[model samples]
Target chain A: MKLQVAIDRVDIPRAVEIIRQVAGTADVIEVGTSLTKEFGVRALGPLIEAADGTAVLGDIKTCDEGKYEFDLGFDCGFAYLTVMGSSSLGTLEVCYASAETHDGVMMIDLLECDEDRIEKISGFENAVYCLHTSIDSGATADPVGQVRAFKAKYPQIRRIAIAGGIKKDQLAGLAAEGVEITIMGSAITKADDIAAACAECKGLCG
Target chain B: MKLQVAIDRVDIPRAVEIIRQVAGTADVIEVGTSLTKEFGVRALGPLIEAADGTAVLGDIKTCDEGKYEFDLGFDCGFAYLTVMGSSSLGTLEVCYASAETHDGVMMIDLLECDEDRIEKISGFENAVYCLHTSIDSGATADPVGQVRAFKAKYPQIRRIAIAGGIKKDQLAGLAAEGVEITIMGSAITKADDIAAACAECKGLCG
Candidate 1:
């Protein structure tokens, strides 16, 4: 499973420092929605450069004007961009097409999406379906079981990612459950020893 | 009736210029979703400032992490911020509470949100319930009729804003229909004389 470390709620300079520190450790480094909303895409050029070859996923959470958002995100050097699963099917289709055209990945954030909605949008083969539990709702009680059940229900959605308060101890179970990417936020970045915590999580998951 | 002119699909520099040109004409100057995804919120700061003491609204379209997105958007001087009506009740609650605490307004973008979802989230009295049509899906065919139907269905939702390709011709009808805010995009911003067009639309609505 790939490890995506989401850096959020921090200032730009501090974020750049964190990006440099965790560059080699993270398979995918996410400039969270907070940063995207706070700094704008062009300001993130330094962080993208700090990626040093790793994938930079901008958690844009685009809900409308998909082509414009996707095109701009790619231009700003985002290897991956996200669109909400709860967005209109038309918006999602545009985002999927934009991602495909740009040779960039699209991750569908299933924050509040229901099965009916998910079923309608399950056709994006190259897209990663994220079972994202909202921070406001707290962490998922049974993430591994959640992934297992999600995969079982939507067998065709081949690419799966799990996020929301993913702790270090849960990596093996998530990896075993066939989650392609496990997103960790405070679990690594907010830790006292960010690099050490990241290394520990990486060792366990990798 | 109030005029909310949306600045969309332009680079940050151009958006700044457009906002400055229309600053006093429109009641609400919207930094549209397209602008939010392009230059980002940081780049939007000057545009926010360009509103010339008029209220600025960032179409941030928060689907999740309500507090983070709302806080950042409000911090960036948006008098109002938007949350997707399709997000979970939990997410909406967080956004509403945050908006309330910050003395900011919440505009619920009801794009593709079902009747059931709308029924569940109707109680935020302070929020401007926006009946939004996706640009990706083309403009609303009959915006006046659409608003009338929505008002007939949910009279409890006191404040109403209508968006998606709202032209100058429709402003009188929307105003007659008791629409609080009429969001016009290319009709004004992409006009031969942008500021004059904005003033005309404002005159028609106001």
Candidate 2:
């Protein structure tokens, strides 16, 4: 499993600093939704540059105007962008098309979406369907089991990712579950030794 | 009834220019989600200052990390910020609390939310429940009927706003249906005389 470290709720300079520390350890370094909302994608040039060679994911959490958001995020140097699964199918279609045009990845955040809604939105073959639990709702009780059930239900969806309070201890389990990416936020970014924490998580993923 | 003009898909200079042109004509000036995503809320200081006393509504479109988004948006001079009705109950609660603490307003964007979800989230007494049709899904079929049905189903939701391709012809009808705010995007902003179009909508609202 690839380790995606989400950097959020911090200022631009601090975000860049954190990226400089953990980018080498994370497979994909995510500029979280808070950073994008607080600093805007245009202002994230520095953060993108700070990512060095690591893939940068901008958690724009786009819900509408998919083409515009995805195009802008890609132009801003994000290798990946996110759209909400709760967005209209039309929005999702446009986002997937935009990502293909730009040769970038689109990660669908499946937060607050029901099975019926997910079933309707499950045909985006290239998009990574993320089983995300909201930060406000706290951590996922059993992320491994959640992934197992999601894969069992949507067997056709080959790419899968998971987020929400993921800890280092859970990395090996997520990897063993055949999850593609496991996103960690405070677990690594807020640690006393962020680089060390990220390395530990990466080691577990390997 | 009030007329809220949305400024979207434009740069900071153009957004500020549009604000200067119509700030006096419209009751509320919205910094649309496109601008917020492309430019970020922190970069909107000049636009906020240029509103010239008109209430600036930043469509931050908070889906999660509620307190951070709301606090940042409100602090950035938005009189109101938006949260998705599709968000978790915990997210909604935190957003409402943040709005109350900031002495600002929270507009719940019911874009793709169903009746069952709306029923569960209708309790934020101070929130303005916005009946939004996705721009990608095309304009609302019958906004007036939609509002009436929404009111009938959830009378407890007192404050109501509606958006998505609202045209000049629909303004008075929406007002007559007791819609609190009618949000117009390209209808007025893309008009030859934006200020005049806004005045015309405001006239209908009055």
Candidate 2 local lDDT, A25-97, one digit each (tens): 8999999998898778999999989999899999999999999899999998999999999999999999999
Question: Which candidate comes out best when scored by DockQ?
Answer: 2
Per-residue lDDT of candidate 2, residues B5-53 (tens digit): 9999999999998999898888899999988988889999999899999
Q: What is the C-alpha lDDT of each candidate?
A: 0.89, 0.92
- Specify the highest-TM-score model's number: 2
DockQ, all candidates in order: 0.74, 0.88
Q: Native contacts retained by model 1, as a fraction? A: 0.79
Any runs in candidate 2 off by more than 4 Å, and if so which? none
Candidate 1, chain B, TM-score (2 decimals): 0.97
Model 1: per-residue lDDT, tens digit, B35-120?
77666776677887778899999898888788878877788789999999988788898899889989999999999899998988
Q: Model 2, clash count?
A: 0
In candidate 2, the residue pairs with backbone N, CA or C atoms under 3 Å apart (3 or more residues apart, or in different chains) clash, namely: none
Q: Using Cα atoms with residue i matched to residue i, what is each candidate's TM-score against the true structure?
A: 0.96, 0.98
